[model samples]
Target: MGRAGHRTALMVAACAALLLAGCTGAQGTNGPELTNTSPVPVSPGSEADPTSSPSSGESDEDGDDEAGDDAPEPSASATETESGPAFPADTKPDTAEPTGEGETFLSVTDVRVAAHDGYDRVVFDLDGTGSGKPGWRVEYVDQATDDGSGDAVRVDGDAILRVSLSGTAIPTDSGVEEFSGDRIEPADTESIDEIVYRYWFEGYTTAFIGVDDAERPFRVFLLEDPMRVVVDVRH
Candidate 1:
């Protein structure tokens, strides 16, 4: 206690045993022993705020680039509305030219005429028996008789020109039989305008002449055969 106070108490006991051996090796390499009655608290960036984040990988790459740019704008708006309208993929329709004058009493096959938008049709292809001799009769005489072209034949306006008889004198009491002769009035004489009488009891007998205004022009006649006639005129 007197060698310089025992050498300053042996250098303060060797610096308090080297500071308690460096606080017991820093609490055994930084694990347990933080005692204020340890409760659970080591919040230093709380585990890097949930798994090594860079804002969660930039929010998952902006949700996969907004789902790949909204998936090609509905397939490019369905490929620009998938085109449209352009008809003519093998088109076909046009045939009707023959207007009056005798000598064509039947013998026609497959003739078609179609004009649209305001109605225009003519189709004929007929040849042969439609009944027994004198089984079909059509007469609208108000005057015109030399087989036609004398003026006085009207239909649709009811001047009385209507006849559709088929087979064996067609009169099973009365299905069709009409003839006008009030002098056959309504005469602008374009040959009455419209008439269609298709008969089939044996083979054929078709007569269709419709024209009310499609630039009027129509005529057909194929008669001569114990009186087998087919006259259609509209002009």
Candidate 2:
């Protein structure tokens, strides 16, 4: 009994030693050691390579640029102005020949005077069986006189401008109603004082314009619808 028991104990002891050696080897050398921390995972398309080239349309030193920053601004002179047609005017005596056919039989039918923004206007309307507009001559005079009789004509003003018209006839010969006033005085006048109208005699007619100022600047022009002779006197 004693020998068998001893032999059994020896076998059990050897078995226990083998089991201990197997566990020590597994912990120290065979497999890697485990921990509570897990390995970090990589994100898709998130990281860039350090050696790669930069993308297009990006500034290296400066930030994003604004469009048209260096362009010049619009100038004030570029803007346009609204104005009427130019009317050339002067103070010198003016004369013009008859237009269209040389022969004419125009008679003064009406007279109009008005005050404007910078001037006073005197218009003489004429109508008859004429083929052309009447010619005229305007000049400053010391004293007004009748063209037919050479008689002194009384006019009231500081200065007088004589307006003589050609290519004209009397009302009876032209078959047109003529203006029937010896003098014309208008209200709200800026430069004019009065006008002395002499009836047509022969082929010419004469008139005197009394002005407020001596030798004021004036302009003469012709207009057509019904044919008119216009005088503009600056204040």
Candidate 3:
């Protein structure tokens, strides 16, 4: 071979070697290695950093929360109750009647009580004439007392109804022996807690009617012929 041919061959060999070395520095189909220096683009939906938190996205409707779908719903409001009995509610006191006032003395013979619909009745029967209107005062109070001695009468119930009859007395050998029985009687009555025969003092006899409740309604009236004082108390 000639010297010119050998020099040309040597230049061509050096050019080929330089081209191969340049191609080796760039990435190829074999993918990037640890030593790669090119900027790596972040792909969509791909995790940028292996140790970083995940991104927040729109959740599906069927997914459950930490409390879960088994949690109960909040409750509603409460309810009320029914009302009370329906009846007349009069509690006024009355003076004596003009029809039956002819006897010298009005004798209290019996004190009776009976239960009725929505009310309890107290009947005071006198053995003498009731021409004079028997004056009476009846009202509920916090305390009960004796009409003569002024001692506190221990009444059992929510309230004590004081019944004062102005023109009745009992005839007894021992200074008018009052009617004999329990001064306080509720053994057979409904709304009445007791029927206490208090005392007869100065032509005025006072008794106590113990009731079951405080807000009950009551009324007072008089009956003819037999001379009876009628007291009606609501349940």
Candidate 4:
């Protein structure tokens, strides 16, 4: 062969070799071929089963129901707890019932008025057991009668008053004399004519009298618990 023809043939052989090398490089760079071992089984009617799987934002509603069942019940109020056996709200209790009893019980048992020496002597009987202490007052009342003509023997605002005490077993004259003022004297000596009124303490009982005038329409109350006497003078 001539030199030019031989060179051209050699160039064609080199070109064919280069083309084969490029094809092999492309196959190697594309990565490995995969093989299938088993087929993935598809479930039938899975979409129709409500409990099969939870959706993206869903939670178990049964947990919420259990929490509601476990919650504690509410408590009652204090008013409801104290509701039974109470006194009626609007009623006032009666005050005349005997708060204390016995011979020495110094409750005001009775009262009477008598005219003596131009003075009205209002007497009281202390029926309870008490030694009448100093905190006693002789209040008086004065009002004209309906006729308004004759002088009504109403309890004068200014009246002489005295207090004494007696029982089946009489209290001492000295005890009765102790309560009288300089102007007033004991009613001319006697045993308890009536239960004028009685008030008692640890070792003493007292009866009361008006040296002057006691306000009329009078009521007497003995507060024995605290040892007090309230003489109400009404018109």
Each model's lDDT comes to 0.35, 0.77, 0.66, 0.37
What TM-score would each prediction reach against the true structure? 0.20, 0.61, 0.54, 0.20
| After superposition, candidate 3 runs with Cα above 4 Å error | 1-103, 170-178
For model 1, residues 134-194, the per-residue Cα lDDT tens digits are 2233333232221223333333433223232232222222233322112212233343444
- Return the TM-score for candidate 3, rounded to 2 decimals: 0.54
Top-lDDT structure, candidate number = 2
For candidate 4, give the lDDT of residue 107: 38
lDDT (10s digit) by residue, model 2, range 106-178: 8998887888777787888889886788989988889898876789998878989899887888877678988
Q: Write the per-residue lDDT of candidate 4 for residues 108-128, one digit (tens) a residue.
A: 333444333322233333333
Tens digits of per-residue lDDT, candidate 3, 174-214, equal 23345665565657667788888865677777778888867
Report model 1's TM-score to 2 decimal places.
0.20
Ranking by lDDT: 2, 3, 4, 1
Kindly state the number of residue pairs that clash in model 3: 8
Q: Could you tell me the lDDT of residue 212 within candidate 4?
A: 28
Please state the error at residue 219 of candidate 1 in Å: 15
User: Could you tell which candidate, 3 or 4, scores higher by lDDT?
Assistant: 3
- Regions of model 2 farther than 4 Å from truth: 1-90, 100-103
Lowest summed lDDT window (length 10), candidate 2: 76-85
